[model samples]
Target: MIVMNDSQYHQLVDDAFERIEQTMDSDDFDIECDINGGVLTLEFENRSKMVINKQEPLHQLWLATKFGGYHFEWHEAEQQWICNRSGNEFWSLLVESITKQSGEELSF
Candidate 1:
């Protein structure tokens, strides 16, 4: 595990969402991606949401969906953020979450 400092964690997440936004932006409807402080909120057309935020004290990223909550930590060797419990990569989880909530496939 790579324990990321607040600055590094923020930059990582900030860049991730920016890429996701660019890739997912479509003419049909926009997936609203907003960042306030350390929390990133993605809103689907159905008014459902997926929330992602940094846990500074734990050096982890936390995600909340309608189905469940998941926590991820930085993996330096893999150059990815992996779930603390499941080891699922952060981008995969986010894509799955969006697909489940919105019935659309997103790649990031």
Candidate 2:
């Protein structure tokens, strides 16, 4: 696990959210992206929702999808968020979840 201060973690997450939003904006998918109170929410055409939020105390990112909930911690070496239990990378999981819910393939 990488040790990151709260400011660093928040900066990383905010940058991530910006990248995600930009990607989504460039795509023509029926997905709505919204960020409020530091939480990112994606609402699909089928009415399914995925939430990505920061866990400040734990220094982890939490994602809630229709499939399940996953927690990811930053891995400095890989420069990616990785699930501690499943060992899945955050971008891969996010793409999979969005495809599953929206039936549209998206790259993030």
Candidate 3:
């Protein structure tokens, strides 16, 4: 596991959130994104929601979807957030979860 200082971890996670927000902004999906208190919430048209938040103490990112919850840790070598349990990449799993919930395909 790679060890990141507090500032570095925050910056990396914040950047990921910003990227997600930007992607949502440019897409035509009916998902609404709101970030507050370092938590990103995505509300879909069907009233389902997905949440992504940073786990500062663990230096990990957490995501909750209609299906289940996932914990992701930053993989410094791959430069991606990878689920600790499933070993799925964060963005890919996120897009998959969104598609499953919203019935629309999205890439981020």
* Local distance difference test values of all predictions, in order: 0.81, 0.91, 0.93
> Which tens-of-lDDT digit does each residue in 1-108 have in candidate 1?
876678887787777767766775653445787778878788888899989887878878899999999998888899888998888999899889889988877576
Pairs that collide in candidate 2 are: none
Q: Give candidate 2's error at residue 72 in angstroms.
A: 0.2
Cα displacement (angstroms), candidate 2, residue 88, comes to 0.1
| Shift in Å, residue 36, candidate 2 | 0.3
* Backbone Cα, N, C clashes tallied per candidate: 0, 0, 0
Each model's Cα RMSD: 1.9, 0.7, 0.7
TM-score of each model, in listed order: 0.86, 0.96, 0.97
Which 10 residues in a row give candidate 2 its minimum summed lDDT? 23-32
- Model 2: residues >4 Å from true position, as ranges? none
lDDT of 2 by residue, 1-108 (tens): 789899999998998889889988898988899999779999988888999998989989899998899999999999999998899999999999899888989897
